[model samples]
Target: MKANKLTTAIGEITTQGYTVIDDFLQPAQLKSVKALLARINGQFLGRNNFEGGKTERIYSLLAYDKVIQDIVEDARIMAICEAFLEDNFLLTTSQSICIHPGETPQPWHADDVFYSIPRPRPMVGLSTVIAIDDFSAENGGTEIVPGSHLWSDEKIGGDYREGDNERDSAFAERMASQSIALEMPAGACVVFAGNTLHRGGENKSNGPRQALSNQYCQPWARTIENFFLSVPRELVREMSPKLHSLLGYSVLSPFMGQVSGSHPLKTLEPGYLPPVSRLKPPC
Candidate 1:
C-alpha cells in the first residue's frame, strides 16, 4: 500500500475502531486457500454456543497451510499492527473461523479485554479478519460498533464475563444498535483495534461463512495461541525470519523468550540441541 492509503487506513482504525481493505488477496490466492482448507477438513474442531455450535474452527493454520502463513505476514496487516501495537508485537493467534448456517450472533465484546490494562488505554493488540467468502449480512459478516475503542471500562459497565467476551445485555444491545455489519467481497480484510466492540453475525444463509482471524499483541504479553508448540521446530525454521520473529523467536530484551539463556531462534538451528549442558549464556 502507498503511504497515503496506509495513513488513511490507520486514521480509520484510530477514529472508527476498524477499517476494511478490499482485494487483500487475489482470486488465485483465495482458490489456493480453499484447496488447502478442503485438504485439511477433518482436522477442524467443532465448538459450541459462544463459538457457534455449528462452526468449525481450525487452529495452527500457518503450519498446515502456506497461504495463511503469507497472509499473516502481509505488509498491510503488519503495518496496522505495528502502528497500533508498537514494533515489538507478537503474532498471538491465527485460526480459520467458519460460521455454519443457523449459528447465532456472538455476544458483543472487545478483543482487548484479554490484556491486563483497563480499556481506553493505548491499543495493546490488534486483529484482522480476512474474508474467505463474501461476507454478507445473511452469511455472518462481522458486526462492529464504530469508535467503541474509545469507550471506558465504566462505559461498558457490569462485570466482565467468562472468556472475557460477554458484555451486559443492555450495554451490548446499545452497542449492537450502533453497529454495522462489515459486508465485503471475498478477499477483503477488516483490521480493528483490540478494544473495538464486535462479534460474528448470525448466519441465516444456507451455507457456511469462512474467514481467517489473525491477532497481534504487545511483545511482553502471553499469546492466545502457543505457536511454539503448535508449529514444530522444523517447520518454524522454514518460516521467513520476519514470521519467525513474530512468533516470539526474538527476545523482548534482558530475559524474555530465551532458550538456555540465549535468544529463542538459536533453538531452531540445525545443530542446537535442547540439553542445557551444551547451552551458551546471553552476552
Candidate 2:
C-alpha cells in the first residue's frame, strides 16, 4: 500500500484504539521476515505458557535480527507511530508469537500490566500485531473488546470476581457482550492502544497461527523488555542508525538511560557504536 493509505489506517487506530491494515508488507518482504523468524527459532528455542496447556512460542531480541529490525523500522510502520505518538516515541518490544493448534484460549488482558509504576498522565503507547499468516477464528485469531481502553483500573478489576469461576463467568459475559474476533489476512496488521483489552483465541485448526507483536511507547514509559540489554552490541552496531536510536543506544546517559545501569555497548565486543547518535538527549 502507498504511504498515504498506511497513514490513514494509523489514524483510524488512533481514534478507535485498534485498526487493521491489509497487505501492509509486500509478499517478498513477508517471506523474508518469516524465514528470519524460522531461523531464529531453529537456533534458539524460546517458549512460554500464557494459558493452561497452551504455550506461546516467542522469539525476543528481534532487534538483533537484521530482517526483523528492517521490517519494524520500515517507513510504513514508523509512519503509523509518528502519526499517533508524534515526537515521543521509542521501540519498547518486538517479538514473534505463535499459538499452536489445540492451545487453550488466552484470557483477556492489557499490556499495561508491565507498567506497574503509578503515573498521573495517560498512557502514551501503542501495540501493533502484524499477521505473518492469515488470522482466522479457526486458527485462533486475536479477540478484542473495543473501547475498553477507557476503563479505569478499579473498573476493570470490578468486572471480574475473585475466584476462577467468577473470572470465567466475567470473561464469558464480556466476550458475549462486546468482543470482536479479528480475522486478519497475511501482510496485514492490527494496532491497538496499550490499554486495549485483548486475548488470544483457541487455535482449533491443524496449523499454527503466527504473528509479529511490535510495541512503541513514549520514551518515558518503562519498557516490558530491556531492549538494550537483550540485544548484543555487535548486532546493534550493524543496525540502521534509526533502529539503534529506537533501541535506546544513541545517547550516553539521559534520564531514562542506564536501564539497570547496563548498556549494550558495554557488553558486546568492540564495534557497536553508530557513526552518529540519531536520537537527541532526553529532555
Candidate 3:
C-alpha cells in the first residue's frame, strides 16, 4: 500500500468504521487459496445459531496450509493492522467461513464486545474478511452498520442482552433497517474496527458463500483463539520469526509472555523442556 493510499484506508476506518480494499488479493493468490480450500473437504457445521448451524468454519487456518500463512502476513493487511493496533499485535482469530444455503442472518454485534472496556472507545482490535467467492447481497455477504463503531453503549441496542446481541425481534428490526450488506468480489478484503457492528447475512443463493477472516488485537489483550494450543510448536518453529511474534512467542516488554522466566520463543527449540521439569523430586 502506498503511503497516500494507506492513509485513505486508515481514514475510512476512523470515520466510516470500515474500508474495503477492492483488490486485496492477486489473481494467482486467489486461485491458490481456493485450490487449497477445495482439498480440505469443508463439512464442519457450526454447533449454534451464533456460529451459523448451516455454515462450515475451518479454524486455526494458519496451521492448515501455506496459502493461509501468506494471507496472514500480507503486506497490505499488516500495514492496516499496524495503524490501528499497537506493536506486537496478535492474531485473534483465523478461519474460513462458508455459509451454506439456508443459513440465517447472525445477530448483529460488535467483534470486540468481549473486551468489556466500554463503548465509544478506540478499537482495541481490527478485523478482516477476505472473500473466497464473490459475495452477493443474496449470498450471505457480510452486513454492517456504517459509522456504528463510535456509537455509545446505550445506543447500540437498549433492549438487548447486557453484553451480547439481542434475539429480540424489535432489536433485530432496528439494526436491519440500517444494515448495509457488503457485496464484493472474490479476493477483495474488508477491514474494519473491532467495535463496528456487523454480522453474516442469510444465504439465499443456490451455492454457498465462502470468506476467510483474520482478526488481530493489541498485544496485551487475550487472544480470542489460543494459538499456542491449537498450532504445533514444531510448525511454529518453521514459520518466520515475525510469525513467531504474532503467535505470542514474543514478549510485550521485559517478560509479559515469558515461559518459565525465559522468552516464549525458547520453548520452540527442539527438545526444550520446562525449567521446572528439570527439578529433582523433593527428598
* Residue pair clashes in candidate 1: none
Question: lDDT: which candidate is best?
Answer: 3
Model 2 residue 281 CA deviation (Å) reads 32
Tens digits of per-residue lDDT for model 1, 86-192 = 55589888888888899878867677677768767877789999999999989999999898899888876754435324436676667668899999999999999
* CA deviation > 4 Å runs, candidate 3: 158-166
Q: State the C-alpha lDDT per candidate.
A: 0.83, 0.68, 0.88
TM-score of each: 0.92, 0.79, 0.96
Each prediction's total of clashing residue pairs, residues at least 3 apart in sequence or on different chains, is: 0, 0, 0
Q: Write the per-residue lDDT of candidate 3 for residues 63-171, one digit (tens) a residue.
A: 9887788889888889999988888899999999999999989878788888878787999899999999999999999999999999988897554334335468787
What lDDT, from 0 to 1, does candidate 2 have? 0.68
Quick one: ranking by lDDT, best first?
3, 1, 2
After superposing candidate 2 on the true structure, give the runs of residues whose Cα lies further than 4 Å from its correct spot.
1-7, 42-53, 86-88, 117-121, 158-166, 251-255, 258-283
The residue-by-residue lDDT of candidate 2 on 25-95, one tens digit each, is 78987998778767665332223235334444454546546667777787766877777664547788888
Q: Candidate 3 at 251: error in angstroms? A: 1.2
